[model samples]
Target chain A: MTRTFKIFAKELRDYFVSPIAYIVICIFLLITGWFFFSTFFIYNQANLRTFFTLLPVVFSFVIPAVTMRLFAEELHSGSYEMLLTLPVKLSDVVVGKFLAGAAFASLMLVPTLSYAVSISFIGDLDWGPVAGGYLGAVLLGAAYSAVGVFASSLTRNQIVAFITGMVICFSLTLFDKIAIFFPAAIVGVFTQIAAGYHFENISKGILDTRDVLYFFSVIFVFLYGAHLVMQEKR
Target chain B: MIHVEKLTKFYGSFCAVDQIDLDVSRGEITGLLGPNGAGKTTTLRMLTGYLAPTSGTIRINDLSIDDDALAVKKLIGYLPESAPLYHNMLVYDYLDYVAGIRGMQSRRKAERIHELADLCGLSGIMHKTVGELSKGLKQRVGLAHAMMEDPQILILDEPTSGLDPNQIVEIRDIIRRIGREKTVILSTHILSEAEAACDRIVIIDKGRIAADGSTESLKQGSGGEHTIHLSLLGADFEEASRAIGAIDGVSRVERVEGANVDELRLRIFAGGPDRLREKIYACVKATDWIMVELTQEGKSLEKIFRDLTREV
Candidate 1:
């Protein structure tokens, strides 16, 4: 666990020191803020539903950019050997990088708190949905981060990782929408596997165990996949 | 001590390292001398547990690479070929991070970092970012990082490769200092470095150990023939050659013109370390020739190395 913490701290330091983290944060905040302010008066909604509604699409692109260089750059630069030769497990590296990306993406959502606060001046704001919306945003970002990190580990090219991650996130986000085009017999499972399937429920101020479990499950699967790739490299 | 038996590594069907057996005693500087693609790096990687072998057993002290890989790794400080490093961080920050992860206490970590910084000649660049440093400086930082934990065994793959002569000497001096206290194994293709720095040399060719011995023993065993060079002012080339070649134990006599037009240089190759010089002197004295030079030279290690690793 201590070794994992050291890796985690190193990755977190890496994010702040590199320009990629700053660029991702600025782009996410600027676009999310512009969209929220542009549509706040038009929608007349006091809560963060509009922001939460736009988050899935935004993260599908932004999170990939953030996580693209996580493992790919290391592999490409031959620093993967240094990382593996350390007295640490493969899962330590995966989890540490996973958390670093997830934590960075989740922090990008924190600036939207002002949107919730500004809405309090205009109309009656429901605290439950706002809190639930932020929780849902973080969980969703963590899951996407895991997927992006796993995609990065599959290849040693940053561009390839970015494209692959965006593709996976896009398909996951809209899998439910595509289910309507498919036969009704398999629609149930297809709908269940969608990216936004459980997000809506969690964004509606409902703390359901199944929705929480789904996000965690997705996060673990991709993080474990990255770990398996690292282990195979040895 | 490290004992390796039947060590092999295969990349799919292609064998990178064939079956090899070796022993490294405690506190001895062993040089793995080989050309490129001779599996020196592969062998070192396997020894450090960075690359798993296809079929092998490496016993370092009481730990085996099979069940106690992490323990074996903990006992080793390995600098891979080219010294891969994180170029983003400052030297101090990088070493600090490594020390923390190596489980060094705060006070001891600082002291150890200071010690390595001085030993590796990195004190002046401790605050500089690794990306901004030169290649030689980067290699020094890599050495310091590998030594951060003070492991008992240090496995370095081509540590002095791609360095200038002065940098190579500095690195060699540091390795020599460290070798006194720690068991060191450094790989190099440079024959002089192995000859100058190592206590024992293990020559590897085409993934196999061609020879392993001290410099003196190797020279004596494989390069024992004595060759004497003679320069005479008046002796003719054919006459000198026939006279020296007819002597006992004198097998080959090579003649060339000396620096002077009238002088003839005869290289007398003889078996065993015998009194060929006395016989050559007597022959030159018998004739009215002026003996300008008489020198006996032993077979150089370079010649022996070529002969041993030569194609069969």
Candidate 2:
């Protein structure tokens, strides 16, 4: 919708004009890029498997830090009330901020492309798995950002939002690995719902519509929850 | 035009706004005056469709807030107590974004932005980021954004709350100018501001209407009775009090200090000021006192406000 795009464009512009977005982006690249080089040199491998494996763990903290202030800052500064009074719908505001966080996450992935390009020079690189890994990382980042936004809606403090989002994302990421100690029947169901299960399949060049649907559904559920939170605030 | 009937909002078990009725006609400026937590903001939010009323109906130009929220919102521009703004955004860009969301065409957006910027005194700060601007400038920018679409109604909640005296005057002038063409509901605790800007004042106390009328009418309604100040020379204080209190329409008489020892001052509570001087002079002539000066003490708006809100 035109209204959604208008909100999206403004949100994106706000990110660039302020130091918060740039600071988060710079730190994300610096830390991730360090791990990328360190893993490649230590392993002496031409593949990006190490980088892909470590991304979810690193993003569990960084993505929430990036998305924590999306709605929380707006509410704290009284801008949420202003936005609610406008002609736009609540869905537009939720989707706009979600897309803004997704766009920032996408930018974080753009710099990692050079890692793919660098590995190509060192040795023979299978672009198939590497491309799939990047796709998986981006989708994972999208889902994480949505959850972060939902947490941000629950409170007006950015720190609380960040911690809450990180906890939720970390729980979802580690739930499957932890469930293995339990009974097999319980573990199977938990793993199916775990973020790592779907991400691992996509990282290995497996294009499962079910996995994509799962990621989208996760994004939708959190975003819808954020919408509900905002409506309750009104 | 706006019509609100039996509007109520509850936060769980606590009622923020009770059942209230009001009508705002086109091109009329109405003032909503109340203390903090008196539900002025909540009521305004409901009118703007930002908050749903617990029970009631709000019809703006005959469009219900529930059924036609978007349509109703499009016809209203609201400025909350704290003008919501993106601090990182340039004024022009922010207004442009609002214009786009309000469905203005790109071609006409520039012209509308320019017009609003000029009207709100924000043309000089069009390129500056909002965070870098002063509070008054930021408020001006908010005003610019609210007027970008030129809606038929403007709802301003304490638009001049934190501004300096000069800024307050400037904002009041702008509001008065805009109110000529647009129906406006200006909310404030400043009675003088309402008296200066609004055609009618709706005073809400404890989630209910305490008084609703023109400034003069409300003052008269709450004044109770008139008072006359009398200064007399060579008069017996007790005898003068008794004589003045005996006059028809005069309720009570109380003694007050004069500038000199020989001078005696008395305040007379009466029906009105008419013929009070004659009655006083006649009463003083019969006695051995000289009537020095007598003047009617007009009732003030402050007294009316205090009387209306004070517990019975």
Candidate 3:
């Protein structure tokens, strides 16, 4: 457990010291910030529905970009062997890197909180939906980051990692909307697996246990797969 | 202490490391010498608990690598052939991170980092990012990171692979100094480097142990035949050669041209050089002619290594 935290701290420091993390955060903020305010003026509403709705779509690209180098670059640069030779467990390394990506994604969401503050100032806003929306967005980002980390573990090239992660995340996110064209029987099963289905439930101020479990299960499945990939390299 | 019992590793159908049994006592510097693709790196990885052996057992400090992996890992510090490092991090920061992962607290981590930096001559470049450092400095930082934990066992693969001459010397010195307190297993293709730094050497060829012994023992064991270079100053070169040939252990003596006319070089094939040397001295002393030079050349490490590892 202590080793996990130690790895987590170093990974976080690695993100801060390198330009890749900052570039990712800056791009995410610029694009998401513009959409948040623009949607506010166009809709003439004080709520953050526009911000929450746009985050999952924006994060599909940004999360992969942020998390693509987590394990891929380490393997490419030979640092993966170095880390494995340490006293830390392989599971700790996977979890530590996952937490680091999650933490960075959380930080990127911090700036969007000001949008909530701005919304509260202008009109009567129900804080319940806003709070739930942020929670849902954070969880959605975490799931995408987990998928990105797994993709990163698949290849040494960071660009390939990014493309693979984006493709996987985009497919999972858009799977529900695409199900509308299919029959009702298949649509029910597809919507349950789609990230958008669970995220939309939480965005509407519903903290369903099923939705929480769905997000956690997705994170677990991808993280477990990442662990398997690393073990295979050994 | 380290022990391996029939350790073998296979990558799919290809066997990278064959069944190999070896051991290293505490505080001894053991050298694993082999040609490229001879499984030196794979053996080191298995010993370090980085790769699981296919059908064998490895125990470090009485702990099995498979069962007690974390404990085994904590006892050994490994430096791979490629000095894997976070290039974006400063030397000190990277060492600190390693120390932290190795379970060192703040005060001890700081003290250990300083000690390792001083030991590896990384004090001057502590603040520089590893990416900005030269190859030598990067190698030193890798050594420093490996030493941060002050592990009981050290496994270094090609520690001086890409360093300059002076840097190699510095790294060898560091290894020698550290070997006094820690059990070290270093692999290198440089024969002289192994001869200078290792207390015992295990030469591997084609994924098998070719030779394993002390350097002196290997030299003496392989030094059966002796080459005697004689410089004759007067007449009776033929008589001198016959007298020397009658020695007890002398199997055959062949004469080759010397650089000067007064010199005659004899390549002596003997059961042992020690027995033949005395007869040559006696024969030369009996002759009334002056003997300019009589030198017995010892077999070089290269010759011994080649003799052991040559493809049959």
Q: TM-score, B chain, candidate 1?
A: 0.90
What level of docking quality does candidate 1 show? medium
Model 3 misses residue A170 by how many Å?
A: 0.7
DockQ (C-alpha based) per candidate is: 0.63, 0.78, 0.86
Please give, for residues A141-224, the per-residue lDDT of candidate 1 as tens digits: 999999999999999999999999999998888888788899999998888888787788889999899989999999989998
Query: After best superposition, candidate 2 residue A25: deviation in angstroms?
Result: 2.5
Per-residue CA lDDT of candidate 3, range B1-312, in tens? 798999888889988788899988999999999889889999999998888788998988889898899999988889988697898888888888888888888999889888887888888988898899988888888888788778889999999998899999999999999999999999999999999999999999888888899988888777566666666677455776687778878777777776777666566667774756667777778777777777776777788889888878
- Pairs of residues at least 3 apart in sequence or in different chains that clash in candidate 3: none
Give candidate 1 misplaced runs (Cα > 4 Å): B223-226, B231-239, B256-264, B272-298, B308-312
In CAPRI terms, model 3 is classed as: high
TM-score of chain A of each: 0.97, 0.96, 0.97
Residues A9-100, candidate 2: write the lDDT tens digits. Answer: 77776777778778887888788788878767778878888788778888899889888988999989998887877898999989998998
**Model 2 Cα shift for residue A152 (angstroms):** 0.8
lDDT score at residue B83, model 1, on the 0-100 scale: 79
Q: TM-score for all predictions? A: 0.94, 0.92, 0.95
Position B275, candidate 3: lDDT: 56
